[model samples]
Target: MVEEAARRDLAAIAITDHDVVGGIAEAQQAGQRFGVEVVPGIELTAEWDGRLAHILGYFIDPAHPELVVGLERAREQMAAHVRDVLDAARALGVEIDEAALARYRGRYVSGATLVLGMLEQGILRGSPHARQLLLRASREPRPFSAAEAIALIHAAGGVASLAHPVKLRRSEPLLPARTFAPLVAAGLDGIEAWQIVQGPTVRDHYRRVAEALGLVATGGSDCHGPRSVGMRLGTQRVPAAVLSAMKQCWRDRRRALPDRTGSPR
Candidate 1:
């Protein structure tokens, strides 16, 4: 993965393990070894209406108690979920086994890793299946969701941003201004205003929403490990002011809470 980033000439890279922060150290080490700035991050799967929502945490401080507690819990639950999926698949005669599970576990280190692998390999189509089959349930071991991801993001001394909301085709439900109004009112900090997949119309809509919501506009490659989804790593740009506002908010929340629990109501 680090080699791929180098090939792209990226100045910085973020390691966002889904619903967990287990890879921060390795990512930092790789960044140092490769001379790319490493941003410690987690891509959390959050419980939403018995479904799932993804919230990305970037530049997060690792040792914060609340964030650490939830991430640890998430990792355990996800491991269990994977086990359950293997079990189910075995019962249904899918030809999957414990050895297969072990082989895949290391590769499927995060939520994005698991889902992206499935997508690339043509196992699942999108979020709904990723939720109902893997995240919400599975054949052997399934994935699991953490507590409110936005809260975890705030607690970790990081920025909280929606990742690929529009991809769901239910953006109006998942990220509608009305739905986000209260979150913004409660300190929702940013949105991925410019994304790799957004067409011009979607870009314009999200941009207007960002301005109206007083949220920082950011963009990302949503790069999963070394793989490319027609989006080159680090090619997307997030304005410095937007980045500053998110960092400032994180710092302020860290100060106010002091106990490592940034409780967003």
Candidate 2:
């Protein structure tokens, strides 16, 4: 990602991996070598009013104790969820390659990994079936609520932002402002107003919403990797001023917090 950012002439990029901060350190080091600024970030999956929401934490301390332990627990739950899915597949008489799955035992097990394993053994036909299985298997409860997620990010000295609101629900093109009120009240510092999937009108709508709620409007390409289809690094063309605003917000938040000596930090 850092290399891609440099190649694209992006001044900076945020590495916000889902439910983990493990990649930030390496990305930061690569950013130094590539002459691109890397923002330490994580995308946490949280529940909001019974629906799943993703929270992006920027400028986080990767080694924060609470964040580390919480993410570890979330990973364990994810592993257990994968086991349940495999068990369900077995009950349906699908043959799984246990040896292939074993490779992901000690690491984060994503639905894509499971689908690839199934594809390798010819157990799954194509994308449609893979998508069905993934959606069905992911109905389990999330580890944190939106409020808890924001609190965790704050505890780690990061700015918390709501990620991809337009993509949050397939049934609705855009969420109502009421849906964002609670999260904003919970200290959400920003909203992703610029996204690869949103059109200009929709992006403007979100930017307006963010402004009304007194939150910074941020943007990202939501790129996963170099080979990811239809997604390219730095495609959103986020302005440098967005980063400056986020940094100022982080600094203000830090200043508002009381230190161990009961003085403002």
Candidate 3:
């Protein structure tokens, strides 16, 4: 992806891998090699109204307690969830080998490697197929409330925004602006204003939404592993000024709220 981005004349990309910060280091190394600025990030899953919501955390202090602890807890839950997923696949007449899973483990947190493995080996054909299999298997999803997830990101001195909300199945308005009314009220900081995957119309939709809702706007590469599918590193160019604006929003919120950590709302 980095090479592609370089060809496209892009400058920077944030590596927002799911629920894990493990890939940030590797992305940084490659970004350095490719002359792209690698922004560090993580995509976290939080429960809201009994459904899972994905949160993208950007520019975080990796060693801070809020983010580090929550991520560790999530990693543990997902590890167990992966085992359950394998078990459910067996029940559904698909045998997912443990060896296949091991190949995708540890390096990235979200079990995305596992999902990709299924695709690569024909265990699953695509993302939609994988999602259906998980649902049909009654995939035992894990827990981390939105409030908790956002707080962790904030506590780590980073900013949190809703991820591609539309893609998560149960969540409405996956693209975010229409989806974030309550979240914005709950101190949600930003929206992904632009994305490579979204065509011009979707980009316009999200931009208008971001403005209408008074939310900070951000973007990233959303890289999963070495082989990022559609997006290359630095493909989505978020001005450094935009990141500064998000952090300024965070500072404003922190000043208004008490130092004590708990429910952000």
Candidate 4:
């Protein structure tokens, strides 16, 4: 990921892996080596209206006590969820090597990885049965509420942004935008106005909402790796001003707080 971003001449990039901070340190080291600024980030799952909404925290202090505590809690919940999925797959006659998965003891097991593994083993091929089982298994433990997630990000001296609000699966048009008010009040600092797979119309809608709500507009490719379909690094060039604005917001928030031990800058 580091090499690809550097090759694309991106000024900076964030490593926002799910429920883990373990990869940030290594990415930071590689960024320094490659002359690319690395923003420590994490993608947190929060629940809103019975849906799992994603929040992206940028410029976070990876070692902040609050952040660490929250991540540990999330990790435990995710591990349980993954175990449940594995069990469900087994019940459905899908063979998953529990011993092999156990090797990633303290790391996150993303649903994509799990499903891809099954696909690689030729045991699953986008079948409705497999999809249904995995979907049911993955939602066992609900995540932190939106307010809680925003507070966690703020506690870590980072700016919290609504990640891919369009992907929230809300049926009502502008439901996400309507919910943004409470999120902003809860300390959301930005909105993802651009994304790799979002069409132009959707992107414009988000951008308009961000502008109207006085929120920072951010963009990202959300590229997982070289093999990520339709996700190309550097395709979404987030404005430099977005970073500046987020940094300023973080600083102001830190100054208003009683503690600054985890200030990212």
lDDT of 2 by residue, 1-265 (tens): 7887898999999989889888888989998899999999999989987788999999888898999998988888877877877887777666577668645322366555676567556776654456566565656548899999999998888899999898778788676677789898899999998889888987998888888888999989898765346447878899889888888888788778766121111
- Report the C-alpha displacement of residue 184, candidate 2, in angstroms: 1.2
- Residue 186 C-alpha lDDT in model 1: 46
Error in Å for residue 64 of model 3:
1.3
lDDT of 4 at 163: 89
Model 1: residue 12 alpha-carbon error in angstroms = 2.5
Off by over 4 Å in 3: 1-8, 25-35, 89-94, 104-115, 122-140, 168-179, 226-231, 234-241, 250-265
Pairs in steric clash, model 3:
1-232, 165-174, 166-174
Worst 10 residues of 2 by lDDT: 256-265
- State the C-alpha lDDT per candidate: 0.61, 0.81, 0.66, 0.77
Q: lDDT tens digits, residues 103-126, model 3? A: 654463234555656666787654
**Clashes per candidate (backbone, < 3 Å):** 17, 0, 3, 0
TM-score of each: 0.73, 0.88, 0.74, 0.87
Residue range 1-265, candidate 1, lDDT tens digits: 6656776786656677666566777878887788876778777776444445566787787777988888677677767765566455445443332443333345444333444445445544433334554553432222334235777676667777766657545535235566556556545677776666775677667777877887766666676543334545666654556555656666676777766654221
Better of 2 and 4 by TM-score: 2
Give Cα distance to truth, residue 131, candidate 3, Å.
10
